[model samples]
Target: MNLDLLKRTRMYKGYNQYQMAEGIGLTRQTYNYKENGKSSFNSDELLRITTFLDLSFKEVNEIFFDNLISK
Candidate 1:
């Protein structure tokens, strides 16, 4: 995952980690772990993030799937 892009986007949208966790029905620590790459985001969490961030399909692909595409 492109964590830097994700963090930047989250900040740009004016959401803190706690708010994002609430929005996505996760605990703050869970969100932090996922954000920091200690854990992965499930598809359901990804969907919630896309909706909460108001992200476009292209943005989702860039932030979540860029590594796969690069390979």
Candidate 2:
């Protein structure tokens, strides 16, 4: 996961670590590690996070894939 992107976007949207973890069905510590780029975010976790954060396709690519392609 892109740690900086996740932190910036999540905070920008008023989501804390606890809420994000709950939304994605993960423990807070697990979320923290993953968000810190220590752990991997599998497809399911990424999907849940994208859905919870209401990310568009371009945003998803930018945040998750670091692709940042123009929409």
Tens digits of per-residue lDDT, candidate 1, 39-70, equal 99999999999999999877888899984553
State in Å the error of residue 1, model 2.
4.3
RMSD of each: 2.5, 1.6
Q: List pairs with backbone clashes in candidate 1.
A: none
Off by over 4 Å in 1: 67-71
Clashing pairs in 2: none
Top candidate on TM-score is 1
Task: Please write out the lDDT profile of model 2 over residues 1-71, one tens digit for every residue.
Answer: 46798899999999999999998899999999999988899999999999999998977988887885665
The CA lDDT at 1 in model 1 is 78
> What TM-score against the true fold does each predicted structure earn?
0.90, 0.89
**TM-score, cand. 2:** 0.89
lDDT of 2: 0.89
